[model samples]
Target chain A: MAINLKIENKAVVEKIAKLEEHLHLQALKGFFAEVADMTMFTLRFFKEALKPRYEFKELIKQAYLIGYKSFPLIAITGLIMGLVLTIQSRPTLAEFGAESWLPAMVAVSIVREIGPVITALIFAGKVGSGIGAELASMKVTEQIDAMEVSGINPFKYLVVTRIAAATFMLPVLVIASDAISMYGAYIGVNLKGDVTFHLFFLEVFDKLSFSDVFPALIKTVFFGFAVGLIGCFKGYNADKGTEGVGKSANAAVVYGSLMVFVIDMIAVQVTSLFS
Target chain B: MKKTTGNKVKLGIFVSASVILLITGIYFIGQRQQLFNNTFTISGIFKDINGLEVGNNVRFAGINVGVVEDIQQVTDSTVKVDMVIRDETRKFMKKNAKAIIGSDGLMGNQIVTIIPGPAGKAQVVDNDIIATAKTVSMDEILTKIKVTADNAAIITTDLAAVIDNIHAGKGTIGKLLMDSSMAGTVNDAMVNIKQAAGGLNQNMTAASHNFLLRGYFKKKEKKAQDKADEEKKASEKDKK
Candidate 1:
């Protein structure tokens, strides 16, 4: 009886170890698979983005939805960001008797770093979640498959237009955001110190150069592309259920925001290298 | 469908506004760099640029009219700075214009200050090498200040010594300023002079009253009264 019990116990331990190994292998496999899938998706996006048969109407529609719809939110966030940044930065600058440096300082801060990063995060949260959930629902209801069966080229029509719209519109939005943020900064400046609109703008522009503007503007395009691509990828491959839609939406925001910071880091490095 | 159409119109407006803003911003920045307008390149060779870099503003008469486009070291003692100034400003920039490296503010970037020369001189043309003045560097000014301060310190020390000497009644000035006995002697001399002057006045009055000088004294008094009456009449006329 002892020998029989020992054999069973040893077999159970082996089985448990085997199961753990299998789970680890599966996780590792899933990670690489996802990476490979994303790479393929990105490659396909490039292919479709340049194809001859352009989806002009769809592009316009997506632009309307993505760019116009999101402007108010972006503008509000930008205003608050500039206002808060100026108010918070006042005491430190006032200590140095450099209160006049407020407009230029805030302009540099917003144009170079804060504006792009914050706007991209907001874009990720709203647009990324929207894209992810929409695609995921279409996936769960078999709409994507139906489109594929009907020879609709669903990826080109849906993913391409959204991605292109994001890529095109984000820079425009960032420019608008920067302008609005400057206005907010002006208000913030006048809250404590009086600055004419012309003088404030002059101060802002005096500090800004091509280096500050171009690199940041270029990065926003990449940021938008990354957010849209990840959102679309996650949603398109989402598991067929209500839970999958929720998961896709969550992952879209998470990964999109994460990539924005990551891209920002890389952009800063590149900019520093050139500068 | 109607909602989509309205959204499209809104998007168009937003996009158009954004594009306009972006273009305006770029134009302003480009204008600052002398990029959009027709510009002429002029070079200036300086002993030192004083940290002035390419893309730094070049100010003419305290107004930014151009930018430092290129900075190159030609020799150990000479640095060549190329400036791109607006063509519109060319008419005003004479051939004798000078360039000097200056700071934007107390703690701001180094900028090139273009000093306009005599108005009668020929205008500066494209690729013209303008004159450059050696700027008095901050270190040089600090050195001068240090020398002045050192001299001031020495002078103050000498002044303190002289003051001490005056307090001790060592020199002539010291005796005059600090010697109590000398002050008393001077006071007695002043008193004697005052008494002598009073006695001299009494003697002169007595002498003038003599018959031989009485006419002269009376004539002088009459002349003085006439002058006073003329002045009073002139003053009354002026006041009226």
Candidate 2:
């Protein structure tokens, strides 16, 4: 008869525990490594951006593509967002007999938080994924290598132009979105209430100060930069396959959206500290 | 090429519109802060600012004529608030104008109200320190209310004790309110007063008609008749 010792069981449990601890440490290390790589990539891009042989035509084309092309989508989403927010907030405000405060309330919320965050998320979803996938495909098909061989910097041509376009376009998009959203809110207010456009805007502006607007707007620039940089960084360093293209796109969106919130949290804290 | 040019025009219009909107917003907000206007600075040193801050509206009379520009701690007990008043309102503001931190409403922003000084006083100059009146802060109001409420609570406790004594017939008010015997005594006094008043009226009438007083009344009547007769004779001689 063979005697069965439970030696494998004890060792297996210990090994599993050790593996978990190691995985946790590895995860932490990987996170730091990823951050370091992104930072270096961004620094390199900035260095490249400042150098001569600027891609002005490409930058303009990218702006046209990113900012002008994204208008319809941003506009529709903004309108819907404003309308929905108004409809939802009505009952609560009406309960307090502060329906008169609708425009100002909605204005503050949209300008200070909702407009920037929503626009950034949309930009991440649209431009972020586009940059990631486009660049990743270029890498996979060796177009980047061809460009590099032909006395052209792939980073400068693609990353710099795209990032610059995104950074500049996002504010434009936010401004348009904010205006459209306010119009939508005005429509929403008129649905159940009677408020003239001038009065509505007046009330909207009366409560809003510089503190509520500039910092909120300033953070959107960083948000755009983060999204563009992450997208470029992820795509440029993609793994050697079609699967990597998908991974790049996914990571760009995930990371871009995540960075928006993180930056927003920091912005809020800093704004509050000053304000 | 034509299509690209058209797209460029569209982009330009879009960018221009956005910039205009943004600039307009900035201008409005800046205007509220008294940034882009002809303004003069006036300040007030206050024992307490009562939660007044930079950008709080400064009202003259009932209208907003300026905005608070800065708040500085001059001493541990004093705060200096600098206000930028609109240039147009400078003539109306006198040297003796007072600044007081007050609220817009029961539940509204704290505003600095500039009480215009008496007419004929020199106009307020730029950077002139206006007189500051102490504001009753919410905390002080609450404290006073708390003291009042405590006093009211103590008084009510004493009142309740006094009322209890009245109910138990332990004091004068208690006896008057609660003692049936005291009520009976009051009723008996009232009855005795009524009876005494009737007797007094009869005695007064009997005294007025007594023989001892009749001679004096007759003498007064005879003197009245003689004086009337002399007056009639003098009138007849004048008529003759």
Candidate 3:
């Protein structure tokens, strides 16, 4: 009986090992499958987007909802970002007796990196989740299905408009955000010491160049596209039921934010190459 | 329909504002680069640029009048810098003006500072090759400082040794300051000089009282009295 029990125990351990291996294999398969699906989805968007019967009205509406409605939050965050960064950086620069470099340094930091990345992340959180949840709920309620049955091109009307709006609007929002941030930085500079508005702007423009502004502006378009694409992809491919809506929204934010950093890293590398 | 049109108008306004801001920013940056302004080009040859790159500001008499447009190595030992100066400031920049590679601040980008020459010289024409002046770089300044510091260190070391010798009563100054025996010797010499002076005074008095020297002394006194009377008469004449 003791011999039998030992054999059974060995069998059980072997079974568990096999199960673990299978689970790992399943996870690997899932990852690759998701990658393939996402690629196909992206290709489909490009195909449908370039076709005739452009969704101009829907595109404008999406731009209004996504870009204009999101401005106040972006503006407030931008102001705080610029102010806090300047305030925190002042002591260190002051230690070096380089407090006068505050405007130029802050301008470069905001225009080159901070302004685009922060704005993209905020856009991802607000608009990415909104797109994801809205589409996901529509999918769950079979509204998307009804639209398809009604002979309407739901993907063209729904996804193309959003992706296009996000692509174009983000650059504009970033420009506005950068401007506000500079103003905030000016305020921060004058908080402890006196720097005239004219001098502050002069210092800012003095350090800035086409290389700094153009690359930053160009990258925002990509950042916007990524956020919108990820959100729409998540929502459109959501699973059945109300729970899918929440999951889609959550995943949209996680993946959208991740893509922003990824794209930023690539953009920096590319910019450095040219510069 | 009305609500949709209103939304479109808001979107249009937002986009327009953003585009305007972007254009304004671009204009300012471009203006700084002398892109929009009427500009004239000038070149200078220098031994070393000291990290002056293209697009660095060119200042004429403390004012940013232009930008460095191009930098090329003419030879191994010389660099050619091209500057795009505003056409408006061309009159102020003379043909004899000298361009020196300077810096914005202690820790700032290198710039080309144009020093105006004698006032009567003609204005600098476009494509004029201006004279370049060699300015002291930070490395050169640091090297001089290092030499000075080394000399200072050596001097201080010698001073410390001299002080040590004074403390030990070795040299003349050291002995004068630190040796008690030398102080005593100096004190004794001073006393001897004082006694000799007193003896000399007595001898002088004795000589003046002698018959042979009395006439001489009397004559000297009379002469002194006559001189005093003459001075008194001159003063009375002056007062009258």
Candidate 4:
């Protein structure tokens, strides 16, 4: 009875070990698969972004959809962000009697870091989910497949244009958002103190330079690219039947946001290295 | 087709606006650097730069008229700084104008301040080496403050000793301030001076009445009376 029990115990342990190994391998495989899909999507963008057929009209529609249509939401969020940052930063700076540095401090934060990252996250939430769900539904209904059958390059038509739109539009949005945020910060500064609009802007820009503006603006392009590509990638490879749509949309946002921070970290390090 | 054209127009506008904003920003920054304007170069040699660096503004009478373009250490004590000034400001900057490395505010960045020379002096020519003043570095100021504080400490120590001596009635002033015997002596001296003064006043009155000095006094009095009578006669003649 002892020997039989030992054999059964050994067999159970082996089975459990094997199951653990399989789970680990599956996770590894999924990670690599996602990486491969992202790489492929990036390659497709490079291919279509340069080609002469230029979906110029579609690009415009996407820009309008991405930039103009999203203005009010971005404006509101930007104002709140500026106001809150100013109100919170006041006491800390006031302790040093450096309340005068408020505009410059707020400007740097908005231009260099906060404006891009927050705006991108907001974009991922709104646009990423929209693209993911819209494409997933189209994919489920076999519309993309139908387009392929009709000799349309669905990847170029759908993915590239949207990505291009995002890539171009995001920088514009960030600029507009930064301007609005500074204005908001001005209102915030004037809440307890006095600063003329011109002097406020002067102090803000006095501390700003190409190093702060260019690298920040440059990173937003990658941010837009990541947000648009991840959304499109998830939707492109979404499962059929019924349940995959919600999962794809959720993953798009989560991953898109994750990638923005990752890219931002790398960009900052590289900028610092050069600077 | 019409819809597509409209969309294209919209995109065109968006892209153009962003590009325009960016270009305008670039232009302003460039203008600040004096990239698009006519400019001239001038140099100054200083004993110390006071932490002034390239790209610091050069101010003339508190106006930003140029920027520090270069800085080179010539020796352990001297630094050579170059400035690129607007051509428009060149006429106002004389060869004798002095340059000093200063700060924007108490805690602000360092800038080269150009103190305009006398009005009659000629303008500084291109690449002219202008005079420089030794800029007071933060360390220098702190060192000076330390010296001053040390001197003040010594002075206070000496003063405290002096005050203690005065309180203890050890010196003349101390005796005057704190000694009861010294006060009594001063009172005696005051009484003696008052008596001597009264005696001198009586002696003067007796001398004035004596014959030897009295004729001189009488002659002086007669001259005064004659002058007074002459003045009265002149006044009466004018009235008549």
TM-score, cand. 1: 0.77
lDDT of each: 0.93, 0.91, 0.96, 0.87
- Candidate 2: segments with Cα more than 4 A from true spot: A1-5, A14-29, A87-100, B169-240
Best by DockQ: 3
Which pairs of residues collide in candidate 4?
A: none
Most TM-score-accurate candidate: 3
How many Å off is the CA of B10 in candidate 1? Answer: 1.8
TM-score of each: 0.77, 0.82, 0.88, 0.78
Inter-residue clash pairs, candidate 3 = none
Task: Summarize candidate 4's per-residue lDDT along B197-228 as a digit string, tens digits.
Answer: 99999998898899999998789889999999
Which ranking of candidates, highest DockQ first?
Answer: 3, 2, 1, 4
DockQ-superior candidate, 2 or 3: 3
lDDT of each residue in B1-240, candidate 1, tens digit only? 898788888988999999999888887877777778899999999997888888988899888888889989999898899999889899889999998898988878899889988778998889999998888999999999999999999999999999999889999999998889999999999999999999999999998989999999999999999999999999999999
Model 1 score (lDDT): 0.93
Candidate 1 residue runs with Cα over 4 Å from true position: A1-24, B118-120, B139-240
lDDT tens readout by residue for model 2, B1-240: 888788788888989999999999988878877788899999999888878778889999898888888999999998899999999999899999998999977657899999887788999898999898887888999999999999999999999998889889998989998999999999999999999999999986786689998777778889999999999999999999
Candidate 1 structure quality by residue, lDDT tens digits, A1-275: 99999999999999999999999999999999999999999999999889878999999999988888899999999999999999999999999888999999999999999999999999999999999999999999999999999999999999999999988888989999999999999999999998999999988887788888899999999999999999999999999789999999999999999999999999999999999
Alpha-carbon RMSD, each predicted model = 8.7, 5.8, 3.4, 6.9
Off by over 4 Å in 3: A1-21, A86-100, A189-199, B183-240
- The 10-residue segment of model 2 chain A with minimum total lDDT is A1-10
TM-score of 3: 0.88
